[model samples]
Target: MTDASLPARFERPSALAFLGYAAAIVIILWSFTGAGFSIDKVVSSPPRFADFLDRAFPPNLEPQVLARLGWKMLETLQIALAGAVIGITLSVPVALLAARGLIAPTWINQIVRTALGFIRAVPDIAWALVFVVAVGLGPFAGMLAIAIDTIGFCGRFFADDMEAADKGSSESLTATGARKLDVVACATIPAAMPAFISTSLFATEKAVRSSTILGLVGAGGIGIELKVGFDLFDYPTAMTVILMIAVVVISIEYLSGWARTKIIGVVR
Candidate 1:
């Protein structure tokens, strides 16, 4: 209870930790300089942005334009849904292999985990570019990109969730002479299902956002429309595209959050 027995208010950082902090600060400053950070530009950006707002205020709300954008938005949703389904389906097997102490051996688990990490490290846009080359510029390419990206996103989380599942059930099943796959199907997967559902919902949301930009690389979505608008300096149309994208993305996010909460609550 004495002052000497109480923990120190602030422990001094280690020499290595201090050095790491200093190095981080230096790197940040170096990056800012390299990236041309400028207070003058920041201070003067408002008028330029205001001018852009003036040009974009009258959103191109023509009925035909709205219909076209609506169709494209629907296509974007389709891409996201199809890709999410494929990726989430594939993630199960991939995660089974990646999960330590699950179906795959430690060596196999490490390799699969490393592969998933590599997949995740590459941006979805980069994947879209690659798929565009392979599949010839369309929603198919965008779907493939979203699928790969979702697999990468969901696989890691799925593996971790499986690995963290209540081992007691698996152990009991094993004691009853159940095979590894049986134990996984009945015990491990069931235990991790809630987390899997939550993760899948997030993957869908992510796919939607990624799909929109995939069109920029000719991977197919409304991105091409946005690009064309900007290229032609059609600011009004560009603003409309931006607004449509915002609405769709926000709506999907809200729905995903609601689904996740409901499902998780039911599970709990």
Candidate 2:
């Protein structure tokens, strides 16, 4: 075959690409340095981990233990619900402001986006720690933490969905001399409702899991019990608690999926 007609063979990566790969590798190695992630350490830890696993195998299913776990699980769900409610309610205004086509004044949109970014920068656990200090421990702190975290994520996602909605309906509403709020309420919200519901459900599922961890810092939930079990070296109790959490999370996921189908209608 003619050289021009032949497919290229063994094309070399560019110098910049090679340098980028080297830099990435260096950064990864540097990160591990502080992490104390030697192969020897990893190998040595397996025996300790195996011993823990042996202890955890027979899960404690005592009635008192189960009852306490059930109550804590309910508290975790309550925290998640409260956070989801507050976060979704508070997100509406911010999301509306952040929607480009919905809201005017470029500076206002910039400010809203910046604030959302700032809120999203912190992890939920960090927020939980802060609120635990402020509120003096309990599900209140967990609720607040999840609310703040969800506001940042859900509001941004909702705003993006809103901006992508069909402008024709909103324009028609405006032509009829509908006020801005009326236009949004009548036109924009319906178009975005399915997406909004889906996002809220997903956020709620995440919040439920996060609420469990918030208890590590004194925010009330199953995490406190899990921490106690761990502290007391009661691996079986800890394993039971972990399994219960897994069950709850899986149940929530299944319910959310069903609800999403109902909200969005059956997908073909």
Candidate 3:
């Protein structure tokens, strides 16, 4: 085609493009407000961090210490697992309600999403504090706190996944004169199963980490043990606890990966 006959392309600068860049810079600066985030501060902190790291190495691996730490870590894992299971189970109905395609009423979806957002806004530590106050300190409080937090997170993600599913399957189920519950069970649930499982696993992994923190507030787990170690200025023991958490987290990540593959079938 001749140059003169070619379609003309717009040369105008995009207003939205400039605005987006400006907004990103503003956000980056705003995020650093209280950090004293200069290059000098960054350069100075490394040596201090290195000293701390040097102190953390050559971890204490005494058999007795390992035994106690292991028990506490197991307790934390149990609390996490229980919390995740309960949370994921409860999230299903709430997620369905929040899914727009599944629920025709805009107000209902809005209400459900708003509730989930509110739950998510408060951190698990805060929930742990509240539960600890009401329940008077235990793994029970930790479990409940994690469960509540997971419900918010998993429910929101699950709803989004469900809403994004193919509409044809759902419509087909409805056309078969199936009940709403039946259609959901057959169409929506199956379609979203892989995502739901993945979300649940992610929530479980997070709950495990959060459960450890909950113990700091007297909610019961390795966190309490960690606090004790810190209070006594036993950096070796604290490091051991931290290492245990790292191992557990890594193990859970592997297991979740395996489970995901099993559920979704091997991706080509």
TM-score per candidate, chains pooled: 0.95, 0.91, 0.89
Candidate 1 has its poorest 10 consecutive residues by lDDT at: 259-268
| lDDT tens digits, residue span 4-123, model 3 | 775668656589988998999999898887666788888899999887668767677999999998998988998999999999999998998998868547899999999999999999
Worst 10 residues of 2 by lDDT: 259-268
Kindly indicate the candidate among 2 and 3 with the higher lDDT: 2
Give per-residue lDDT, candidate 3, residue 114: 99
State candidate 3's TM-score. 0.89
Residue lDDT tens for model 2, 138-163: 99999999999999988898998898
Error at 253, model 3, angstroms: 0.4
* lDDT (tens digit, per residue) of candidate 1 on 1-268: 5666868999999999999999999999999999999999999999999999899889999999999989988998899999999999999999999999988889999999999999999999999999999999899999999999999999999999999999999999999999999999999999999999988988999999999989999988899999999999899999999999999999999888888878787422
Instruction: List lDDT for all candidates, in order.
Output: 0.94, 0.90, 0.87
